[model samples]
Target: MAPAQAQMGTIFLLFIGISKAINDVQMLKPIDLSIEVLILGEVLLSWKPNVNPELESYVVKYNVLIKTPMKEEQYTTQNNSTKRMVALHKGLCAQVCAVYYEREKETARSQWAKAKLQAPPGANGTSITNLSCVIYTEASNNTAMDCSWLPGEEAPEDTQYFLFYRYNIHLEECQNYSRSHDGKRHSSCQFAKTDIQITEDTIVVIYVNGSSKHSTIKPFDQLFNPSTIERINPPMNITVALKQESLCAEWMKPVSVWPSPCFTYEINVSDWVTGSTKQLTVKDNSICLLTNSQSRYSVQVRAAGSDLCGNSKQWSAWSKPVFSDKPQKASVLLLLFLVYGALAGIMLLSAVLCTRFQLHRRLFPQVPAPRNPFKDLLSYNEAPTEGALEVISDIDDPEPNE
Candidate 1:
């Protein structure tokens, strides 16, 4: 009886072993393969697990084959994860299979479950093209800078964008931005304003990523320096003063992503009434005009990065205009002449009056007085000179009769 029982047990064990071998040989392939494209140039893959319980027991891992326009690569994961993430590109394809191992060697693999890569819904359906950055500094705020870009072609109307930057050993996302006048979204973002370091060896690189309800998910990267895309701010606080008979313009250097000393400036002076303009360039912030004949003048200041900083060709937008008033040269000369003529006329009149007074004094001084005839007649009668007394008596008698 003991030997019979032992033989039976042996037969049972062999049958069990045969059953496992059959299951291993017939391992079920994964099904329902799917792929999702993600930002950061990655793809997510998922599949349905095999349904056979006996086959599932022998399954140790999943093997994925990825194909791109450039090359193909295979990845094996020990974990029975239904999903995996891998690098992705355009025209990407993936196939997943259940891997069965026996004695540390692949015994069986399910048929390939193929999946075509696709962008997520609401994402830009295409990769970004012509990606670029324009870096600029704001004079009103000296601590931070803004980087801006235009959206690529086929970008959705409701698309929203975000920017990230890497410099030297630091990497971070840009958080702040300048908005439009109506508080609408703008295509720019701001970097760190404080507690950071910038050096010559530091290389600044920017990444722009965008998404929408109907667009693909991808990030566009650009490598650059502050000077490469540097757009200097317009000169600030433009001032005009009348100094030493000339119009003098004084301004402050634009706050810049680069040093203030790395900027060159341009000044434009225009006479609105005369329809003339004068333009000049300078390394400094001040300009002095020897003379301007126009009464109504306007000045605008602009700037560009100097060649020392590797940006010397482009100029910034003109600043808010500064207006000045000065009397025209012809008008000033006429006023001066009129004042001199008035002074000369007053002096000549005084001289003429003095000459006339002197002439009158010399010509009319000590004129003699006329004698009275009645007094002469009375004196002659009293003196009794015969002929004079007779003439006086006759004249006095004739006067009394008349």
Candidate 2:
């Protein structure tokens, strides 16, 4: 029984020594591990050697394992030296372990030092394809712009995309995003009114790009003038009329621009007969009067944002021309001449009729020779006498008395 107890005690000591050895190996983990993004999807990993003196002497190199959503990579570095892993994407986690050589035979790994990688500055990739933008002015006169694009060629399903813009000297990323039908992120962005710069010489530029675990593209960039795109709809439904001696033109504002007051118009007037053209600028949509009323005239209108608002310097497309003809003076002169001639002819006819009537009465005189019918009858029965007093009675009853 004593010999059996001695053997068990020795075995217990051996187990305790093995546990100590395992504990020492576990405590050889690297200290002060940290990660930083240096440049171009490359990460710099740094750590310090273990504080244990014996473990530090045995350490030979460090092994790095960078795990990404797409794949994992392994790297080796000299002991106590920082390791740089290239071609890394965002959402990367790093695991590092101290490699120690045991008796010049094999390498042993320490505990892992894990971290998530930082994103590289800006989007990396080739130019995005089929990028388009337009001002989104709703019926309520809201000032906003929408931009969209297709992803880069052969972009993986796990690829991520981002959009940014530059106007003048300022550069910024688009924060107002619109989602796809499934509520997932899409390759579209909205720029509000406040994001726009409306200087007299404003120039806007946009860039789109994508990134994946192993690759990035050269960013695709484009430049634009907001005025050239916004308010691009031509003036609509123009009407022209003759206003007294001048040509009048009226048109409705473009439906593509917002806040009607922000627009200014250019009215172009041309003479069809003379082939001469005149241009006029007005804040309103109508030109009250145009010059050169003697010839037939045509008018066209276009609009742009004023300095008080969008400050768009570029003019939109012109409206379809409208035409008007001025009244002629020859017709009025001919009408007056006809009216005067008619009046003069009527007056002359009245004068001629009055003169003829007077002349006829003067030329033929009327004479009176008898005063009564009985005198006429006595004259007829008696012979021709110069003058006589004659009386006649009723023929049947008073003949004896006469």
Each prediction's RMSD over C-alphas, in Å, is: 18.5, 23.0
- Which candidate tops TM-score? 1
Clashing pairs in 1: 122-212, 122-213, 122-214, 122-215, 123-215, 123-216, 124-215, 124-216, 125-215, 125-216
RMSD of 2: 23.0
Candidate 2 residue pairs in backbone clash: 124-217, 125-217, 125-218, 126-217, 126-218
Residues 204-223, model 1: lDDT tens digits: 65666676676565656555
Candidate 2 lDDT by residue in tens digits, 217-292: 5455555667655644567789888876767787887775455787889988887767889888999887777455
TM-scores vs. true structure, each candidate: 0.44, 0.35
Cα displacement (angstroms), candidate 2, residue 269, comes to 0.5
TM-score of 1: 0.44
